[model samples]
Target: MKNTILRFNDAVYRLCIAVAGLSMLTMALIIPWGIFARYVLGSGSSWPEPVAILLMVVFTFFGAAASYRAGAHMAVNMATDRMPPALRQGAAILVQILMAVVCLFMAVKGWKLCANTWNQFLGEMPGLRVGVSYLPIPVGGVLTLLFVLEKLFLGDQSHRRVVRFDLVEESEGAA
Candidate 1:
């Protein structure tokens, strides 16, 4: 059971990385095109700026979830690291609990925000709904929540073979 859950989470982590990476790559490509179009072509494209902004939102949210799972997210451990072992453990658990609450808030409130604006459409991208653009909030919230639970129960899979590709390659080379 534990192995199965870990495997599933490994897949989820990969998916988040892919989504975030793709969004960033697309934004990178499109922004340059937008600049070129405006300066060289003497006309600006309407879709690029709005699309880039939306992609940025996607990149931020999804990338954050992946970073959290990989233990790459920013964390202020100055105070916690100074504590005794037992106190440190308690603080870690408390931090996870607080993270869960924040995730829940993001998921619930983000979903409501999406629903409330579902009918509205973007002026820049008329066919796309405003709510659709905000989808990363709730989706990222749920993904982060999953990682939080995995850490709480499975005890930090950051060192796992799936999460640590560099370590895996080193081990394989040694073998």
Candidate 2:
């Protein structure tokens, strides 16, 4: 049962990522076509640039959520480093829960904002005409929540120890 849920979660997450990626790819192709036409053929595109920006916004938010799901977000844990291993893990879990709550709040707020402007359109840029700048918020929020829940399921919160190695040419110190 647990494995099934994990598989479903991963599938859903990947779908979101694919959607975001397709949007970006389309935007890139469209914008370049617009630019090339305007420059070479001397015909201006009706709305390529604005469309690109809108897609960019979507890409950023969705990408962020994807990153969170993959555990790609960064944080410093030096403060917890000195604590005993057991205590350190507990502290990390606490921090994760707190972060999850904050993210959930943002998601709710963002979804509300998106809902509030359902019939509205962006002024001055019709091609950029998305009523919701709030899409990314929910995406990020949900992803963060998923990550937190996954962490709970795993029941491990040990902070990874990173070893930075300095590679330098070996010079004799005359020992």
Tell me, by lDDT, which candidate is best. 1
lDDT of 2 by residue, 1-175 (tens): 7645555566656766797899889997998898898999899876777777777878877777666666676767788998999999889788878978888897898888878876677764653324465577777688768767776776432242212222111222332
Question: What C-alpha RMSD separates each model from the true structure?
Answer: 3.9, 11.5
How high is the lDDT of residue 16 in model 2?
A: 63
Question: Please, what are the lDDT tens digits per residue for candidate 1 over residues 1-175?
Answer: 8977887898899999999999999999999999999999999999999999999999999999999999999999999999999999999999999999999999999999999999999999999999999999999999999999999998998877784556546877999
Estimate the overall C-alpha local distance difference test score of candidate 1: 0.94
- Evaluated at residue 52, the lDDT of candidate 1 is 95
The candidate scoring highest on TM-score is 1
